[model samples]
Target: MSEVEVVVAHRERATLRVGDVFLKIDADPGRTDIEVEAMTLAPVPTPEVLWHRPPVLALAALPGTALGRLGEPSTASPAAWAAAGAAVRTLHDAPLPPWPGQSLDEVAARVDAECEWLVSNGVLPTDLVTRNRQIAEAALRPWTPVFTHGDLQITHIFVDGDEVTGVLDWSEAGRGDAHFDLATLTLGHEERLGDLLAGYRADVDLDVIRGWWSLRSLVVVRWLVTHGFDPFAPGCEVDVLKSRL
Candidate 1:
């Protein structure tokens, strides 16, 4: 048997890899419930839920390597990106889940609060925060709610030979803005967006997606720092913010 290995250990949760099985432990059982349901409902491939015992949920490992890692160059082919795009498109078009996601007003308020904190602490230049906030306003308007992966990042998708093998981390899945998924996927790799959008074949508001990118980067910086992670790492969240300036 392979030795158990820790994949992630954050304040809120932890994931351990043991042989071909993954064990996710969280403080809240409701989150695990959502993950299990989302996996079941998603049209795209997802890691199989092996079992669940209270806070610990067991999952079978998926095939293939991650499509790409955050804060690093993507070695995945353009076709893989396209496949991921199509998978996300399929998910967005699927029927809505029972739960509701954050409303646009709630998101806008969070963005505004985060921006104020950033400027007050001198964590970032005032001009940079202001400009991005202006751009972010485009995303705060009403949008038709669709199923979203909430945190659909490059690191969460697995691919092999231009095919999406699986998607992981579905605790945040719910009805929300579709551009949020697009923005989350293309956060730091904006140049590759065309390849993904080409595969999606659905028209989306580019400006709104860009706004989500800025709003997300700004709000997450504080959380990352508090968790002992660096947002300023090369090609990370801070870098994405700087790119918009």
Candidate 2:
């Protein structure tokens, strides 16, 4: 038997790899359905869906490594980063998934709640929380809904050289803000934003993208900590948040 490599094991979900197959075990089957459907609809490369039975969905591994991590530098070339950007544009241009993601109001409310949580728990300085909340407000404006990868972290993208091999974690695919994908991908890797944006080639509101950087960093700390991941680790989420100050 092959050793089961734990990809991620959180309160609501877990994923594991055994041999060449990755099994996603989710708490919600509906999300899994959405993932399978999104991959089918997306024009870009995606892993072959092997099978699904109840809680577990099997997927074949794709070529290459992740573009980068949140806190670490990406060794992928600028061309590769641009390729990622192009791939994102393709996905955004594809048909919308059946579901809908958070609206601007929903996002604002969540940020507000998380900010209060952080402040009340003394997790972050009140001024820091307050400042980021204001920054986050910029992203809370109306956006033309597109098919967005609700979570477009670099880790979800696999690349070989300058080309994208495949993208993973389609559970969050839905109609949402385009800048959200850009912001999510470039988080903590601000230096590469210019390269990515160059490949993206469409005019975007920079202020909102920056707003999401602050907004996303503020909201995710609690979840990461609760899941036994250290958001405060060097070159990690907390470090990214501190970089803004």
Candidate 3:
């Protein structure tokens, strides 16, 4: 019998892997629905949906290892990172999905609230939060919305050698800023940005990408803490924030 591996578990959702199949348990069925629809619409490679039963959605595992993880150096070749970037660009170029993404105002409000919490609670130094908040402002400007894989974390991307095998986690997919996806993929791995941009083959504002790095790191710290994750770990979120200095 294949052993069941707990991939990730939190109050909102849990994913389990048994043999080659992954089972996703989400508190909101709507998220799963969106994931399914997004995968179907995405032009890039995505996991094959084995089945869906309410809260439990089963998916066939992709063939390759993750592109990389946050706080860790990626062993993937530059070509592989570029391939991942190419895949992202393809997704962005695809037709927009039916659902909309969070508005700029909404994002700003969240950043403000999170910064306050980080400072008031002494989670992060006030100066650090303040500077990052200032930097985050750059990302708040108007942008052309594209189809985005809203949570384009490094671990969600898979690569085999120099080719992108597949991308995972589509629940958060929607129409959003293209730079947001770029920032998310390159977070904690700034050195790879150039390689990625080469594959992306589009002009982008570096400041906005940096701003997103700050904005995303700040907003996620609280959630990580509440969810029993350690953002303060070496080379993790805190380190990413400190790099902004």
Candidate 4:
């Protein structure tokens, strides 16, 4: 029998791997529903669903290794990074998902609330929070919606050699801003942005991407802390924010 490996386990969800199959257990079935549908709709590669039972969704693991993880240097070549970008473009070009995503007001409200919490709780220095909030404003404007992987963390993308093999964790996928996906993918790995844009082949505002980098970092710090994650780790979210100064 294959030994079970704990992939990720938090309060709301957990994933276990047994041989080549992964088992995702979420407290909310709605997230699993979205994940299943999103994988069905995405134009780019996604994990194959082996089976799904309520809170537990089983998947066949993709063949390749993850592109990289936050706070860690990527061993993937420039071509591989570019390939991931091209795959993201393809996903963005796909037809929009039926469900609506978070609106501009909703995002702005969250940013406001999170910033206040950060300052009040002393999670971050007031000056750092203030500067990042100012930067985050650049991303508050309206945008054309596209099929987006809402959480396009490098760990979610898999590449084999110079080719993108598949993407994972579709629970956050929906119709959203294209730059959000781009920003999420390149969050800590700013050096690779040019190579990514080379394959993305689209006009993108660097400032807005930077804005999202700040906004995303500010908003997620509290959650990361509560969930037993280390956002303050070296080259992670805090460092990503500090780089803007």
Ten contiguous residues minimizing lDDT sum, candidate 2:
236-245
Q: How big is the positional error of residue 59 in model 3, measured in Å on the Cα after superposition?
A: 0.2
lDDT of 3 by residue, 184-240 (tens): 999999999999998999999999999999999999999999998999998899998
1-245 in candidate 1: lDDT tens per residue? 59989998889899999999999999888999999999999999999889999799999999999988778888889999999999999999999999999988899889999999999999999998998898889898999999999999888999988999999999999999999999999899888889889889899899999998999999999999988789999999889888887
Best by lDDT: 3
**TM-scores for candidates 1 onward, in order:** 0.97, 0.97, 0.99, 0.99
**Order of all candidates by lDDT, from best down to worst?**
3, 4, 1, 2
Compare candidates 2 and 3 on TM-score and give the better one. Answer: 3
- Give the runs in model 2 whose Cα sits over 4 Å from its true position: none
Model 3: per-residue Cα lDDT at residue 9: 98
Between candidates 2 and 4, name the one with more favorable lDDT.
4
Alpha carbon deviation, residue 86, candidate 3 (Å): 0.8
TM-score, structure 3 vs. true: 0.99
Which stretches of candidate 4 lie above 4 Å from their native place?
Answer: none
Which segments of candidate 3 are over 4 A away from where they belong?
none
- What does candidate 4 score on TM? 0.99
Deviation (Å) of 101 in candidate 1: 0.6
